[model samples]
Target chain A: MKLPSLRIYAFAYLAFLYAPILLLPIFAFNDGTIIAFPLKGFTLDWFSQMFANDTLGRAVRNSMIIAGSTAVLATAFGIFAARAGTRFSFPGKGPIMGLIMLPLVLPEIMIGGSLLLVLLAIGIELSILTVILGHVLIATPYTIAILNTAFASLDRSLEEAAYDLGEGKLSTFRLITLPLVLPGIISSMLIAFTISLDEFIIAFFLAGNEPTLPTYIFSQLRFPKQIPMIMALGTCLVLLSIILLTIAEYVRRRGLKKTGAKDTGGFL
Target chain B: MRRSTASWGFWKTLRATSRSELPKKAPRAEKWRRAMHLASFQFPLPVLSSAMLRKRAAPQETRMAQGSPLSRLKHSEAANGLALISPTALYAILLLAAPLLTILAYSFFKDGYLTVIHEVTFENYKAVWTDPIFRAILLRSLIVSGLVTLVTVALAFPIAYFLSFHVRPDRKSLWLFLITIPFWTSYLIRVFLWKVILGYNGVINSGLKSIGLIGEGQLIEDPLQMLNTVGAIAATLAHAYAPFAILPIFVALEKIDRSLLEAGQDLGESRVMTFLRVTLPLAMPGVVAAVLIVFIPTIGDYVTPELIGGGKLPMVANMIQAQLLPLDNKPMGSAIAVSAMAVVALISLAFVFANRRYLRGPK
Candidate 1:
């Protein structure tokens, strides 16, 4: 009890942060229409409703496609740039890398709004493709950030030795470098995928008539009756996101260990 | 001497003629001639164009001394570097740079009735600058976002400090991980959950009523109009950004060398004194980073205030959304977006400049 104030404050702080979100699953399962304390007996109706909705299914499908495409696209681009960045000395390296990571700090609304204008001006129809484009732009930075460590920590001597032994450059890269950084690649893909999946504003502005999951959830918010179902969906999404992030963090950490690199913090 | 000079001239003519005919000759004949020339000279020709490398290189002889294999590797490396990075560079330019510049360009144009005027003008900027409501919303958004940053960082510091200093090192990541799980959830859902919790008949009110804080069946009047207020929005925003604030500050805190704190304590400073004198100063970079990360996005946040504040307290983002979506004033929205980015850039620059000492860390 000696100066226990800090401990109590920390507990209260975490509660304040998490308690509201914890209510998401609670009220989703609650049988009552009104979201409140008196939990009407639990039921699976909201889950059923969420699964039965055709629009929700379509939105889910659209989101999955966008997220998957973004993950692959961003990670592929990330690998090349990260390899170039780590393995070679080049001009304008600082500015080039800075621009690549700029989206991490730039306001998403600006990105979404500007891209929306540009897309319209160019007469490219807004679809899940445009959403994927935007997601890839944002997700690329995260992928590169993850892959930089992967590429940087790699022992250069291994590649040099392969080359010295008369291995072709492409074959050497394929045989040695790819397998070593596979964990980083996996981590980057998962992180990029998660980022794209949870993303809203870019998808909202650019998806046009197509509904992604976040946009669908936002649209459904106007109708009070759909609240419970949205909650159920939220519950499932939160669970899935946790699992994905945990695996991603694990892979990233494992990569660091494999390369004997110091942990410089990660998603976790 | 005359015969030697004549022989040298003959050999030079032979070499020149052979070089000229080498391209037309078969590969085997060219290789045989090159091998004969090398054997006669007892040395190999430089792989790099000696004239080009020497003319460009200030340390010409040094590069020549490093020889062909390394130079060939370097040449191919430069090419490989370009080849590797070209795709991402192209993608960023086309997707990110072009659109951002377009937004900047659009801010200077006029919006027609239903279409954008191709004529470039500063009318949009002028209108956005002069409009009082727009100015007020912009200022209010900055203030609200600033407050949220302050509140979030303040709240996060204690938890981060506790986690960094008190928790077992082995379990620290677990604690950090648990705290950040909420962050991975959809931001819209998180905001909506706040709405449900703070609504007039929402969780808090219902919980209070059930405990008899309000009279039975007094549902007609709102017991607490918690929703649709700046404070509520700030609270929700702070909650949403808590993990962001915590993680950075935790990283900064954990980086503080334990020896420094021990040294401070050994010198008769209390734990609190050591933190204020040593820890706080060292962790400023993280705090600033946390501030910038939370502030910039929250200022442009349309979802939180729209959902939680119920349009009563519109942020700059709401106005931008209004102009773009319903009003169809793309130029005005573009101007607002530009102005918002400018304001954030200015504030961040100022913050960084003001805290240059702390942010730069220990010399």
Candidate 2:
């Protein structure tokens, strides 16, 4: 068809994708109890109420802890897997990597349900720690995908030269390989943090009586009075996600440049 | 070609270093150099051409004969690789594989009063398959996911095509970044926002009422009643999965050689015909991928149904959740989970098989 029509269609599709999210800030600032039309003059009461809520505060704290721990653990595991898969030949590599990536396609409900059963069967109490375990399992695949590119694009001669200069394997890796993939590591951590922060299903199933940000939002969604504050919270989360993703994309591109590799694509 | 040049530089440096530092152990150093060469050659980089792989394999047999089995096992690259990957592997086995197995095993076991019994039986699966409620929910889940996949992939194709074919190369990444931003945001919030837009007395209804379209006793008696419907659920899921559908199609389109399109035109095919015969077929693999990527996840989506459907239209996920948690029927829930997964896997495999011609290796 015509290019102009196609362009309009693209823009309209984007609007559809973004319309609900854009409505968040609009309703968040509206000075009204109920979420409806015909603009109720602008106000920041929701934001203030969101700030002053103690449960919301606790939920935010809980989410930060879970996200932070998930980021570190997932990224560390990603580094190990990425380094091994990219740099060495081994038996069962296909199946091993496949198993690691299985969570990507598996349903979140399945993962959450299965994990809940296993944890209960093993006598482990559902808590933020259990949520972390689920989050890390899901997040590690993404980190591995990102880090694999970072590790694969590296110049093998750089490491070989360090080894030839009498550096031990561990020292050579620590000094050379670590710095080269540092940006990728940072990108992976940020993405993992974002995933854990936004995750709902697993956290809902695993976090027993604990209020992570998503579960809190899910609970308050049913209340009309709490909807506006939830919108305010949603606005903040959308902004935070955008910021984190932008940084991740920037660092990923910068890493590609530093390694003198071509940019294929990124999470963005 | 670049790899060969790099390898040349590496060998030259290695030989120069060994000659200068270890003159007395030249033979041993030569053996080490050969072993290093074999090590490097064994796992060629991802970008290696088949010709390069064949050339690199010539000296592997000699290297394998030079070392004792135990000593080689200790020094082998496989040993190092396995050691490095052990932690991640163990974690996956313990958490992912073990849990999945537990779910599978539970599907066969019987549920007891507030607890699962150790006795194994097929009662849960029998119930899941025989129960009309379970069957209807599973069917609805399939229909919703299929609708989502179709709508998402169809809408995404035009945009992905525009970006790949019409947009400037310099601005493609900007378009992609814009497309993906919504997908990265909080999914719970996104689903909730849909409720605000589609709920009774929501933005559309209230806006219509203010404009004198919908009212108590005007042109319409009640609101549009958009929420708690299958259409709303499909629309929400379609929006959520749009970027995923776009990316793969865009990648496939980007891989298409422009010269082929020109060649098709030169062969007297019309623009529409060229697109239909050449572009569409070539993009099938991506379309298939987009289908699976969108279809599989939406089947398991919990938030969209719960929020948009208002708990009135419970999909398989909700059914499983109800059985497992509120009803405390572990065996039934596990059976439902396994059954849903089996259906998804079968459908995905069928799709891939149907499209195997397009997905075959490039000539």
Candidate 3:
């Protein structure tokens, strides 16, 4: 109450941030093509149309393949890197870790362009595989970030205790360490999947003739008649993203709790 | 007053009597009582409170303590670290590092009419540096991104402060959670939503028209042209990057030792003075981090400017995209991308240095 204006300002800020995104579902259900308002009668024609499109379905399938593969690869890579980073320090550790995290901030356009040139020059054709390659590059950093917290929070004594009890290193990892960090792995996979699923530029550049969801939406945006269907698709995507992120955030928090780690502000 | 002191004496005597029978439980009971007091406490500690430092360093200390037996652990750990990290290291080198190095190499190569000439030269870099359009777009991109960072961080600070200081401990996570829900939505769609809202016949225009701010006939003729402008881009960028700004700042604020603020106040400073002299200074690292996080990505963003800026106000990323694909100028694109990366790298370094300075207290 002492700074009532600050409270109001925060609310307004949240509203300004969320209001535009709230429009997607509104227009998706509106029985109109033009994005202008006068609240047309409600209809699900756009959603039905979106479902009936073959190209849209193929794009969705392509995106799913790319996202799934990227998630597994990135999370797997993340587990190793995070474990190493937390457990040990070596020469050039700082620089190596910095280089790995660079893609998180580096422009996707640069990575996409660079990758496209290299792949083409090397006589490799572009496809969903190339997109997955690009996605793993971007998603790996995020996975590492999440998994780093998980690995760091792990009580090292737990591992040492297992070792003290005569368990081999690999068996100790499997029996104790892996089970302890399972939540972290699941969280990392979910985050990587969400990131890869919604990724645009890399998929745009590397998909070549293949149509992913973003590229399809971008292409369809040029046609005025397809706007409603795109809106419908956007609505569904927004819902899916909310659900996925909720689960990811939940798992992340749960992992932190299980490991007795302090929350340092994750995706949620 | 006499009765209260007498009761306190009685309580102390009672505790002393019970201690003999429950020696092990005594320390834990006292610890629980102290914890409850700290939890309900509203004041803050002085700058660099050792208790806060100890609390923060608890995990690190434990990690180091577990890292004894140097000769044995080192050999095994070193080998295990190398083995464990190799897959990711190899992946980065093959996909990310190789591509980036290729781009650097390509930046020096010549682009012939049909085939890319293998001959290396400084032609592309020279073109990027000397071209007035590239310079203008680069400057514009930096300015736009700077504005976005400033606005986003400024708006996020108070929200983060409110969350850290005003919100209840139990509800803070929920508020933070709600704040990030918008982030889960596709960023491209969020940018596109801004386009819709700011379009000629879009939400803003229609709302103004319905409110009679514009004549009915003028709706089509004289709508506010907000899209494709720098202001629009900045607004959209700020909205898109709010969570990125808010979360870091909130984390920084949350980590502040509350007794520090109380110490300042106890030293005869007013509330505002205490905040200015204590709270803001401690939160600077987070603010710097938030700025860097928002600024770096926005400066290199092609999508927002492409969709919302409508190609009229192309950022450096947009120019790079044009050269790489439609313009058939990979060398030039690589040069621009590399230049942008260098600039971003320098800025990040400066931010990292600033964060250290903040942590070390202006020394």
Candidate 4:
């Protein structure tokens, strides 16, 4: 309760969170090869090398491909499911919806292991495609859960008005509902994107031979000198994730406000 | 830890008990419906229609059982929901169940060198349960993770509380966003940073020595026993799982009515006392949820423990992974997986119970 203690503890914890992240750019700009914090002159060589290195380049490209595919696939499933869940008074809805949300609670290792078994059983090659499928399955639940409130918040009267002018269900959904929930859709997509990009266990098992960014990082840790470059990459990723997730939290709040749902969670 | 508990099969039986509503909806189609029910294909669409019929006839049930609509809705669509949710239900069932079943079967089978010939034997569990290494590792994991969860929650609570209660409303949104930013970054990167900073030529070692706080380079390669010990493992895991812990706690704290805390203060309680009595009680569910969020995942988490626990402390998950892969010992691995699941399931059940109790109790 004391102001001084609060300030001290808060500062210490914040430093704990930020200090390692701050090191990323420092060593990244260092003229010397070592990462330890002695005075090293500045250099952009590592950043330049980060751009030029063939393996890192391939890994980054692969990561982009995987992450992008994962985001789209996850969001698409989320949309249909969320629509069904929010609008219709359907049978077995609660249980079906719960089933969709199971992956959010179930252990990732179990999911990853089973997926690996099935992929192996069916003789599907371990590749980005399989990884995308697994990510979509896991990430869709989160996408749907977040978007459920968004879709549910929209007034059915608006859709009925569209219907009054002779608009069909599909047309009314497009013209009226889609515009109302676009921000929610966008936020869900970004959240799904962030989740997919950072996911490891499924990617680890299903990634066959083509490595992802996380996988690449995992392999690089086996070598000592690569730690600095990894830190640089990590620093960039931390900034990027923070930015995207911030946007997600913002859009989530904005979407809720736009649709006028009482903020149970508000922004956070 | 071998928990054999199963779902209520409650859904399956619910349909069988609710035959009264079926006749009213499909008086003409009763035969086909009955046959379908017999076949156990009482799927989703039928269930929905049945639910509609049930809702229409709800007055009678309301008078009879004195139940809420939500509870009645359970019986009407129980079979159909189960059938409709079958694909996903089955997916989870197969995905989680099969490997665990494999583990259970293997735990009963003897471990072999190259070829894992499946013969039923209980010797593996007997051997594993008695081993000192297993006992030590298991205890070490529990103690370290318990400490980590405590520390993480203790550390995260105030920040979450501040961001929720004290920060300006405008800045509150972005600050919450900043809290989750670390989550999206590579966990390996953060753990490795700790490694570098704590190493001999690393930041802490050289910086300390230079400042005359300790002798030269004693920090780094001098076996870093402390750096990579249980302490580092706990630190890294707490760091990784803090966001998870904080989110729930923040949710709990944010959802608390501010007036109540003020009311406590108005009634002559100090701020700290008010927090302990009112705000903290209201946030108990969140605190429990936070603990579970950190604790459940921390159990199977091999990543942080592997990186930071160094070689001295191989957690259960690491041992299981070792067996499943290079060791070619599926049986032992399955046993480990099953046991770990048992531990997780127990914790998860307790967490749910605690959450329910807290939500319903005095606060």
Candidate 5:
């Protein structure tokens, strides 16, 4: 734990974590098809190739569609569940909340497998729709947990004032509650979208013929040569996830500061 | 002088002997009842905490409220709360609960080649035990997961310790950001990268050879032998679960009271002994949490093993996936799913039990 040793250990750990990531962009820009060292001359040909593939483009489009839908649906549900747990008094409330959060601890395989069985029983064939439904189930709990604090911190009187003005619940929520907690809502949506986008095992089980990006990436890696492209895709995903997570952290911190709950919640 | 000194020494002797009382043992049923009670108690704490929070927070409530006091918002607040969470509730019912229900029903059925016949039977469970491969892979999955848990926790502890205790303010986030590297990319790509690194004529052997570390022709090929070995699988899995291990340990470290460490030093323990006696014991919760996080998921991991194992090994996950996807044997697959879930549920229960007793708080 000496300062120098700690520094070395910290940097080495970082190198181990990030060296492969560093390799991705390097190879992505390499003009040569090979992805070995003794650096190939730099070029963006592979990125250009990425644009030419219609199927890849379509997959991206489909992924965007699914990610967006999952985010909105999951966030909407999260806000409700979070509110119920935070503000309401009802019987069986704890069990219900535990059930909502149950998927968090349960294996994704179990959830996915069980959902597959249920979907088949209902004659719902796997598709992007099915994938979206599954994503929503897993993502909702996280959304709810994150939004719970935001909902908890909201000055309830804002909604109360709207109600006293004779506004209905829906309108009050739309106008007062929604606007004040918008930062949390946005954070929940971003995280949910990223979870849906990068999610694989669930998407693999649910996305029958219509593959999402992760599934597409899975299939592409079956051949050794396609790995470089996968690395390129991974680099893009890594960059995207970092941006998404950073924005999520920023918005969440801002929301916490806004509500004056910044120092607590103990590691989030 | 003699009388006073004798009295003081006698009192000290009495105190030392009195301190060693035999610990009381609760009856088995008593312990069980208390556990059930404690878990039940925890069930409402979150709800109650938020409510009691309302009272303590009254001052801020008035400042933030539009017109009336903050507590007045409760009448309309509950309604708005329900509205916000409806989508999450609806999706959970349709996708998660419904699918799990179907599996429960299917677990009772029989499959014939292409069709699933609906008749309640435990034959699938019986068949699950009879299958040798199922037994082997289940055990293998457990072993692999145990290795992954052990390795990742061991590796993550030092880095987490560095971040939590050793680092300056400016560097904490950077180290955490670095630790998050494993999580940022497609998991499949990382698996494939290890495939190259561990493959015959891959980097490890070839690089070793150029440096005269190993002779030529000693390059590690025969991927059928090496790729899917437990070692390879665990290495890849360790990387995946590292972030999971880091998060909880980091949290636990941050929660460590600095005064306790200073107390240990004030007691004249050396640095290493202070860490062993003081810091390690307190971080036990994080270690247990790390195991739970890493072990549970690693056991269910089919993708990493499947991609990297090259058909040599099949974890329970791969088996479950195959049964449902390609083989189209839904009943058996659902059975596999149930079996796997049964194991996870049991471990989780034990984890809760341990958390209550050893870590949450003093009795």
Candidate 6:
């Protein structure tokens, strides 16, 4: 009962944080079309409608493709930058890293607008590929942030030991360094995938005719009839995100334990 | 120098002699010196001897004894690091830096019928600055973001304090995970859900009616009009960014030395006074960071204002989007974007400068 007021306040704040998201499932299964309150019988019609919509399917497929490609590409780039950043001291390192992490602070609208202008001027077609390009630009910073921890916590002597045992640099990296940071790499990819999947502004501007999940949801939000289906979709997305983030947190913690590094908290 | 020709006994002898001669250092340094010795022995060269091995093993001596600056640069660790990071650095420069510079350039150019004229002019900036609608939206964006930042950081501090100080260490990550779950979900959906909850016949109204709080004959004539207002926009943003605010403050609170508070108490100060004098000051950096994190992004938030405000109350972001896409005025959009960014940067820099005292010193 100590600090009862503060504890109650904290719980209330958590409730506020979760209230809207907790509404997703309630409306998703509601037997009525409207999202208002009342005792309506439970039904799964929204879920069925969400699954049967061909456009929703297309958007899902497109989002998965974009998220997958972005995760891999951003994580690959992250590995290079993170390894170099942690293992070696270079000239202009600060500014180089700053430029790479700039997207973290810059507004997405600015990034989206600027990139759109450049793509148009260059005569490039807008597609999921361009969306991937934009996603990689933003997601690489997060990946690098994750991988930096992974690389920094590593014992350098392990790689040197492999080299001393007559292994080449590439083999030393492949055998000694890869296994140690594999958990971190997975964590980075999952986070990057989640970011790309949930992203709306960049995809809206970049995906000319294609429908990603967020943009599709945005489009559907305009129609009153699509509310329940969108709610169902939101429930599924929220569930998927929770799963991904859980796995990411688990892998990151495991990586910390494997490296014998102190737990400094994680992305979650 | 070939590894095939070297014997274990010879290597052992070499290590013994070098270890005896070299000054004592940390074990890691000793290991590094051994690795350097091993590397020199692995070099493919003729006429290798223990003297050459000793000379090569002492990297500082050999580095000082090397040739020209360009040749030195070729083999320098900086060069290797640069080479390794080139792929990522190149992508950033091409994608992020180039596009940003293009936006800056486009902002100054003349807007043609459909095509952007290459002629550089300040008319776009002039128009953007002088427009009443742009000014109103920009001001609204600033006010809404500031309000959200204030509310979010205030609300987050106590929770962050609870997590950092009151919670058991073993369960902190679980608490953090739970807090961040809603943040990672689809933002568009979250914003839309706010509209569903706050609309005229939304959850609150219906719930109130069901409980007999409001109806046709009740004191209140109509369901509360919550949507299409700045307060609704701010509330939605504050909810979305709560975790963003909590994390920084929690980190700052975690870094404080517990002994400081105990020492303050030992000096005869009450708990409240000790907290006011010791803990709050130490947590200011996190507060400032949380402020910037919440404020910067929320000002540019396009979804919340569009959905919660029902597109009737457009922020700067909506204005920019309108100009760029719907209206096809690239120069004007670019100008507004640049102006908004400049204002945001100025405000952020000023805030940082004012709070620079707390930001200094080792974490």
lDDT of 3 at A172: 97
lDDT of 1 by residue, A174-232 (tens): 99999889999998998888889999999988999999999999999989888889989
Instruction: List where candidate 6 sits over 4 angstroms from the true fold.
Output: B1-75
The global C-alpha lDDT for each of the candidates, from Candidate 1 onward, is 0.80, 0.85, 0.80, 0.68, 0.71, 0.86
Question: By how many angstroms RMSD does model 2 differ from the true structure?
Answer: 6.1
- Classify candidate 6 by CAPRI docking class: medium
The interface root-mean-square deviations, each candidate in sequence, come to 13.2, 5.6, 11.1, 6.6, 11.7, 10.1
Per-chain TM-score of candidate 5, chain B: 0.76
Can you rank all candidates by DockQ, best first? 2, 6, 1, 3, 5, 4
Model 5 misses residue A263 by how many Å? 5.1
List the candidate 4 regions with Cα displacement exceeding 4 Å: A1-8, A84-99, A105-107, A261-268, B1-124, B216-225, B266-268, B351-356, B361-363
**Tens digits of per-residue lDDT for model 4 on B6-80?**
011222333533454565654545555465454433332333444643443344344344367666655433333
The sequence of per-residue lDDT tens digits that candidate 5 reaches over residues B170-253 is 566556755764674567667767776676655555456555556645543332235768899998888877788887788777
Candidate 1 residues B1-363, lDDT tens each?
111112222234335535656787567756765665554343212222222222322222243345586665556534556678889988998989999999888888888888888778888888889999988988889988999999999989988888888776667766777787788678888998989988988988888888777655664444788999889999899988888889778877888999999999999999889989999999887888788878888898889889999988899888888887788899989998898889889998999789888854345
Better of 2 and 4 by DockQ: 2
| Residue-by-residue lDDT tens digits, candidate 2, A49-115 | 9999999999999999999999999999999988877776555565677788788778899999999
Error of 2 at B213 (Å): 2.1
> Where does model 1 exceed 4 Å of error?
A1-11, B1-82, B216-222
> Per-residue alpha-carbon lDDT of model 6 for A44-131, expressed as tens digits?
9999999999999999999999999999999999999888767665556656777877787788998899999999999999999999
Better of 3 and 6 by DockQ: 6
TM-score of 5: 0.81
Model 3 TM-score on chain A: 0.97
Clashes of each: 0, 0, 6, 3, 9, 0
What is the total number of backbone clashes in candidate 3? 6
Docking class of 2: medium
Evaluate model 2 with DockQ and give the value: 0.54
Q: List residue ranges in candidate 2 displaced over 4 A.
A: B1-68, B216-219
C-alpha positional error of residue A192 in candidate 3 after TM-score superposition, expressed in Å = 0.9
